[model samples]
Each structure stands twice: as structure tokens, then as C-alpha cells.
Target: MIHAYRFYIDGEWVEPCVPKTLEVIDPSTEQPAGTIALGSAADVERAVTAARRAFAFFSRTSKAERIDLLKRIVAILKRRNDELGDIISREMGAPLAMARAEQAGIGATHFEQTIKALETFAFDYMQGSTRILREPIGTIGMITPWNWPINQIACKVAPALATGCTMVLKPSEIAPFNAVIFAEIMDEAGVPKGVFNLVQGDGLTVGVELAGHPDVDMVSFTGSTRAGIAVAQAAAPTVKRVHQELGGKSPNIILRSADFSAAVTAGVRRCFGNSGQTCTAPTRMLVPVERMEQASSIAASEAAVLVVGPPSDPRTDLGPVASSAQFDKIQTLIERGIAEGAELIAGGLGRPPHLDAGYYVRPTVFARVTNQMTIAREEIFGPVLSIIGYQSEDEAIAIANDTPYGLAAYIQGDPEEARALAGRLRAGSVRLNSAAWDSAAPFGGYKQSGNGREYGKFGLHEFTEVKGIVGFLND
Candidate 1:
């Protein structure tokens, strides 16, 4: 077995200050896949200090320097993409193809986007002779979740690096191998000493310390709503900028005028895309009251065909949940859905018949679910979908926005109707039909889903503080 017990601090890999170890289990096999050191508050101090020192010089670098650094990092990332994909598959339980296509791909995509943004970004602007300037926000503390490991890391790290803000990242202990690989990539690219750091540990200790540290000017976190609240509370006293992308119960509205089979089937497939672990997954499908039965049948039929198995298996379209804790939680939520009287349309609690071990979960679907149903309301973070029926367009929009979350929403209909409905949705992002992602667009949530934006120009701005140089400029 492999052992990753060292933390990256001050441009070097060293043992944790507090000597604690945790076994990393493979979700697909339920076996001890590896081991990593668990850092403590003291370790957080060391990392934060390193980043603080590095920020003094790194933050002053020109845009050209940052662009060169990002270019080198991108090249190194491409060289190690396959290895990163393998590590992600073993630690996070995504199918190998998915890991390669989506997981490792995050690194390259963010690097490219950051480089492009830096090339065209205007750091200084004149508005009525105010001479506003955007400067680095100082050392940032980043805490990322496991489900979309690279996605969150790149979204945060890329911007931080692009804007010359030094940072210390605490990736999820459950699937941290990918983070380690990413650190290696940064090092290989010759990143300045102490500019970037990594510490492996649980949320209660390291995460709290990082968020609450006085030296940390900003905290960018991506995780559950509970953990997000804790981060905010910890950072409140310091008044640090806290940017979070938390949980979601996003909606997928299927209009009566649309193609029912195609839409419902595509929705179910999208829900199960990442083993239903995506925060923005369309977990709640809003269908017309008159066509509830028909939509339910389509979702059920589609879910049954999902292939869940080992992550390394090429034939497996989806893999197991990230860990045993997630598996238990998913099982409990499935039970609650049934108890709440939601109609079970497809799979149910427990693993797929072929898989005896691992943290695998049955792809489940509930039909005729009301907005108040437990499955429809809570963020299950599993491979489960709930079909809720609505009578009117107003009711559909109401049901979609009823949850505390406003991360993303989907609308299906003819081009004109879908576009109109998309405009009316309250979520941060609205998908019309099979709309492709525009990396240049800003990404974040509304309401309790969390604050702040990441991606494109907005992402670069997240790591900066605006300053006004009013009297210094000549008329």
C-alpha cells in the first residue's frame, strides 16, 4: 500500500508537526488503500505563516510573471494527468474514464482559463479620475470537498495564483491523493517558495484554524451547509472574506410541451452522472401534474440501466460513493424517502447486486414527491432522484425556488419557452436544453446556497481587494 504522510509546506514535503495518521480507504473495495498524515492547529499555523511570508513578494509580481508561472503549471499538469486520474479513481471512487475526463481535466481547464484571463485582465481602471486599483487580497485559506476534488481546488487555487495571492489549501481527507498530485505539479512548475502550501487534516481542527487565523485574509470553502456555517462563524471574528459554494437541491423543470421521454431520461442520467454526488445535480425533477405517472416511468426505466461498479473498470459508468460515512448517510436518506410516502419508482436502498463490498449505493428514484418530502428537500449527496409534480408554471417556479438552495436549475421545452423559463429561475445558473458550459461566465449560488463567485473574470476578482488612488493621479 502507498503512504502519503507528508504535508507540503514552505515549498517542501515534510512530516506533520503533530504526528497523527489516518487510513485512506478505497470506496470501491472497502479496503485500506493508503495512509496520510492528519495535521493539527499547529500545522495550520506553520502553513499560514509560510503563505503570509510568501505573499509579500509574490503578490507584487507582474501579470506577465503570473502568466508564465501558470503556463508552466499547465504543462506539468498535462504531463501527469494520467497518474492524477489513477489516484483520483482509487481514492474518490469515480470511474477511470470519469476521473480522466472530468476530474484531472479540471486542472488543465483552470490553468488555461486563468492564463487567458490574466492575458486580458485590466488590473487598473479610471472611473471619473478615481484611479481604482485591484491588488492581491493576501494569504488565503482554502478548504475543498471530496466529491469534485479538482474542480473546487482549481477554481480556488487557479484564481489565487493568477491574482498573486498566496494560499494554503486543506483538501478533503477522504480523497486527498489528487491534491497531493496537484501540489507536485505546482512544485514541478517552479512555483516560488512558500507561495502555495497543503495540509492534510479533518475539518474540526485544521479547517477551523485556517478559517479563523488572523493572517488569513480570505477563506474559500466548498462543502456541506453545516461545515460552511462553521467556517463562516470561525471567520466572522477576524472579518475575513468568506467565499463558499455549499449544498444544493437544484431543480430540473420538464414542461408538458417538451419531449417527456428524452427530457426525463436525460435528467435521470445527469443525476447519476457523478454517482449523484454533485452539489448542483438536478436531484429534484419538476414535472406536470397530469404527466406525473409518465415521467415516473421514464425516470425509473432510465435509472435501472445505470452501471455502478469498481472505479477502475472501464465498463463502469458510475462508481461507489466516496466513503463508508457517505454510504451510511445515503442509505438512511433512502429509508427516510420511503417512510415519507414518496413512490419508489426505481432502485432502492443497498448496493447493486454485483457489488458485495465497497461503499456502493443503489441508484434510487422517487416519483410523485411533494416539495415537503424529506428526499425532495434535503441534499442527499447520493445517487437518488425525486420527481415532484406541479400544476402550473408559477407553481413549478415556486417549487424550484422553495428550497434554501439556489445553485442551479434546468428548464426543458422549445427554444423560446425554455429560454423564458430559464430567465425566471432564481438559481445562480440556468441550463436551457443541453447548454454547454461557458468557462468565461461567473459561477456561484444565490440565497443560502453560499456567497461569492468563481470562474472567469469574477474568479480573478475574488482574490483581489479594490483600492482607490484618488489624489495621486495628475489631471
Candidate 2:
């Protein structure tokens, strides 16, 4: 049983000043899975105060010291891998295998990657006669989402620790168990008091306080674009550095030079992966207008083959979405697609017939979708795919770039052509032929997908500030 009824602050499990609670639901069964204390502005102040006090000494720790700390943390994390997988699967409804391999394992991966980056990183260097110094930015307020709970937390928290910054994290109330487990890991690793804290609450109180807190030097948030805007607005008064990783309606384009069957199949799988909760999920597919029918057929076959069932079942390929809100939203969008004349190619408007009583959504597909359609324009954030046809390669690029979000895009075709086409697409990252995810490569977005980058050395830099002292080496 996962019991998390208190906040982790100042290296201790403390009760909330205001005793509010939220019952976390297991999406797979639509039942209460866990209960967590809800924090208020008073709670934020306590955590922030702890972080501020710790930053004085923590920020000055030697690089070697921080490295040792991360190593210890990673060791504990690896040992608790299965426990984290179980908690994450229950709280957020990812399949057990995926929760272990992708969700929980990625947390360990982030720390390992940060360790590698810190080993060779130079905090200070000379540019001509000038000495350049990089220092920790200070206490960070981190707001993470339920979709990839620990991945977001690790990316932000690992780098903060590496760069000698302290932090107070406000994990999504929807999936707080994984974060509580993370707090346990930190305590086991002997992390310094106040260097890391976890608070639980809604965006209204905890999130706003974190963003607008005078003591917070930076606020890093990952969620919907709408909520990201609120965070930026709240931070505007404090003038604290704000970094956001928001939503995406990413595009997947299949060039005429590629094999239609292979490209379309891959695109469908990626779109539905993680129950289509990934912000960088390729929700929109651009295919040749003439081959739309064939592409739809291939995509439908792929979607049908995917098994959606209880998260415990090892054979289950797709699990329920995170909550009822997501399920309802997806159903509405699928309904809108049909109403808007977008061809409903496969799977639509309800739970899979085999299993009932959960937040499960069918793996849906829509063809003949234009860029302006509601299903194409909005970020449905479910296992819904929209295939838009293009007349030519130029039209394909135009159609793909029409969205307000450009977090990620995919291209499948001749290698050289795909490489050339990648440059034309307006997105933070582009993959040619479904390349494996690279930890070192920067992950973020372009346009309204939100500002700044994360992962690897780039993430380490986000928690730091640079200063150039002129003529420091004068003789």
C-alpha cells in the first residue's frame, strides 16, 4: 500500500499547515489508489525557506562532492526500480513493463546522464584575458506533470543538484506516489536537509506561490501550454527566470520516397505510445494526398493490433489515460472530428468493448483531416491520430508547420532528403526514420511549445548563471 499523507520538507516528513487531502485515483480501475497531504501558501513558504537556507552551503559544494551525492542517489534509485514501477503504474496507469522500462528507468537514466555531463563540465574558463564564471541560480520551484512524472522530476532535480542549486518540487497531485517514493530515495541517499523537498497541492495555491515566491530564483514547469502561461504570468512580478516545457501537436510526415507501409505503421505506433500522453507525440500525420486511403488502411491495421487493457496484464499495449477528464476530452475530440467531416478511419468515441469501468479510450484515427479542423488544431492529448493529406512535398511541409506548437516532428524518406527536409520544419527536434531517443540531444520545442531546453549538459546550464570578469588574468 502506498501511503503518502505528509510533505517532505527540511529533510523530514512534515504535516501540512492546512490539513487538506486529495485521493489519487488509479485510472485503470477508477478507484482510490492513495491519499496525499495538500499544501497551501504557508506550506510553500516553509519549503522555500528551507531551500533558501540550504542554498547558501549547498551552492558552494565542490563538484566532486556533488558527483558523489549523485552516485549514491543513482544506486538507491536502481535498487528501488521495481517499487517505483509498481507505484507509477498504479498511480498513473502506465503498463507495468512501460512504467518500469520507460517511466521509472528513465529517471535513473537522467541521473546517469547528469553525472557524465558534470564530470567534464567547466564551471569557469578564461575567454582571452577575461575569466568567465558560472554559478548556481539559487532555489528552484519545480512543477511537473502526471504524464511522465519521474522523467520530468529527474531532469529538473538532477541538474539542480549537479549545478549546486536547491529546490522544492510541486509534483502533480494526480500522480504523487512516484514523487513521494523519490523523496524516500533522496533521504536514503543522505541528501542534505532542505536541498530537496516535495510538496503536494493544486496549481492555485502551491503552484502560484512557487511561481510568485520572492525567494525562488527560478521556476521550471512542465504541463499544458495554458498552465505554462499562468506560471509565467505569476513569475513575471518576481522577475524570476522561468523555464517551461509545455504541450505539442507534433507532426509526422511521410515523404513520397519512403515506403508507405513502414512509415505509416511507425507513425501510428508512436502516436499511440504512452496512451498518447506525450507532449512530443506525433499526433498529426502528413501523407501524400493520393495515398491517403492506403496510409489510412495501414494505420488502422496497426491501431487495431494494439491491445488496450488493464495495466497489470503484460500483454496490454495501451492502458487507460491518466484520468476521467482526459477520457472525456478525447471522446469529445473524436466526436468533433466526425462532426467536422474528418474521416473516422478507425477506433472512435468510447472504451474498448472488452473492458469497461476505467478511464480507457479507444486508439482512434481520423483521415482527410485538414489543418484547420478542430481535431487537427487542438492538442487532444490522447490515443487519437489525425492524418492530413498534402499535394506535394512543399505542401507537406506547409501543412506540418501550420500548428502553433512545434515540440517535435518526424520524417521518413530517403536519408539525404529527410535530412534536408528536417531543416525546413519548424520544430525543436526532428527525427529521420524513427531514430532512438538520445539523452544527450537537447529535448524541448519551438514557437509556443515553450522556451528553453532540457536533458544532458543543456539541462545543467539551465540551473546556472554566467558571469564574465574582465582582465582577471592581467599580469
Candidate 1 residue lDDT tens string, 161-280: 999999999999999889999999889899999999999999999999999999999999999999999999999999999999999999999998788899998899888888999998
Best by TM-score: 2
10 residues in a row with least lDDT, candidate 2: 1-10
For candidate 1, the lDDT comes to: 0.91
What is the model-wide C-alpha lDDT for candidate 2? 0.94
What lDDT is reached at residue 247 by model 2? 90
Candidate 2 error regions (>4 Å): none
lDDT by candidate, in order shown: 0.91, 0.94
Please, what are the lDDT tens digits per residue for candidate 2 over residues 284-352? 999998999999999999999999999999999999999989888899999999999999878998899
In TM-score terms, candidate 2 sits at 0.99
Clash number for model 2? 0
Q: In candidate 2, residue 91 scores what lDDT?
A: 89
